[model samples]
Target chain A: MTAYSATVTVRLKEGVLDPEAETTQRALERLGFELDSLSSADQFEIELDADSEERARERVTEMTERLLANPTLHDYEVSLQQR
Target chain B: MTAYSATVTVRLKEGVLDPEAETTQRALERLGFELDSLSSADQFEIELDADSEERARERVTEMTERLLANPTLHDYEVSLQQR
Candidate 1:
């Protein structure tokens, strides 16, 4: 089996209410960082032991869509790296 | 300038208290997933427009360390992808 790592990122879609993001943006502005917009985000680093890269990618994608993310209000992307 | 996207994942080190992870694990178990361990996690998808890939990577890494993550209690890895 090959060892692979998957990074999955989930972020709120535009037009979504994200109090956390708003507060963070305000804090950044106070810290003197110029910013346009901020979005609430989350990510996962999942280690997978699978037969091949293709299999790992497929399984991780399935996991992200099925369990790791909420499809309604969140969008996610998955990237696989061999270890 | 090159357009790049960064994905940063922050997770608590092992032995840290993760109430959110625990609750999520329990819910997953109820949904019939066999999980051995669960870790609290978060991620950011940052878009960067920089002069070079190296510059973008450096800036993103700095941002992750200085602002995006709390290094004492969390560890993060940043990956850059061309956009």
Candidate 2:
């Protein structure tokens, strides 16, 4: 088995409204930072041992689909690296 | 002013305990996926108009320092791109 790390980035779907990100944007503007819009995402980095990089990403993708991200409201991307 | 986007990534500082990540890791293990460690992060992408890329990053760094991330327990990175 080879050590690997997978990074899964989850974000609200394009049509989904994100109140928290909006709130954060307003806070930044209140603090004098100039920004037009803001979007937020959650990133999960998982370390595991797998026979190949493909296997590692496959498992991590399953994890994202199952628990890390909500399919109805979110979209996710997975990137893998050998460690 | 030119359109730009800044992505700020925030993650727990080393030595700090991350219960949510731990719980997620455990859940993955329960589902038969083997992993060594897990970590989580928040990413904020801000779209704005700025005089220059440097100026944009400056404001976004302020945003990260003030509201997007808590410096006491989190470490953050900033990346900028022109739109």
Candidate 3:
């Protein structure tokens, strides 16, 4: 089996209210920084053994669908590379 | 002025403990998914107006160092692009 590393990025869907990003923006402005807007996301890096890159992607995709991301609230992207 | 987007990714420092990721890994395992390990990070996308790309990078770097990441416990990366 080959070892693969998958990077899954989960982001809130557009038009959704992101309180965390709003808070971060306010904090930056309080520190004298200027910005139009800000958004935040969660990224998960998974290292696992798979027979092929396709299998690794499939497994990680399933993981994201089942646990890492909420279908209603998040849009996630998965990228993979050999470790 | 031009619009810029900065993506700042903050991750736990190597050797640091990540309970959230550990919990996530166990949850995935409970669902019959197998993985060697999992790590998690936070990513912030900041949109702002800047005079130049260099200025955008500088501001985002400061934001990362001052607010987005804890220097003692987390490592961060900032990537910038025009919006």
TM-score of chain B of 2: 0.97
- Maximum-TM-score candidate: 3
Interface RMSD of each: 3.5, 0.9, 0.7
Ranking by DockQ: 3, 2, 1
Worst 10 residues of 1 chain B by lDDT: B31-40
lDDT of 2 by residue, B1-83 (tens): 99998889999999999999999889988988778999999998889988888888888888788888899999999999999
Per-residue lDDT of model 3, residues A1-83, tens digit only: 99999999999999889987898899999999999989999999999999999999999999999999999999999999999
lDDT of 1 by residue, B20-52 (tens): 867765775677544344454776666767788
Enumerate the candidates' DockQ scores in order.
Answer: 0.29, 0.88, 0.92
Per-residue accuracy of model 1 over A1-83 as CA lDDT, tens digit each: 87787777778776778888777667766776443444557766667678888987887677667777878888888887887
True contacts kept of 2: 0.94
lDDT of 3 by residue, B1-83 (tens): 99999899999999999999999999999999999999999999999999999999999999899999999999999999999
Q: Which parts of model 3 have CA positions greater than 4 angstroms off?
A: none
Candidate 2 residues lying further than 4 Å off, grouped into runs, are none
- Candidate 1, CAPRI quality class derived from DockQ: acceptable
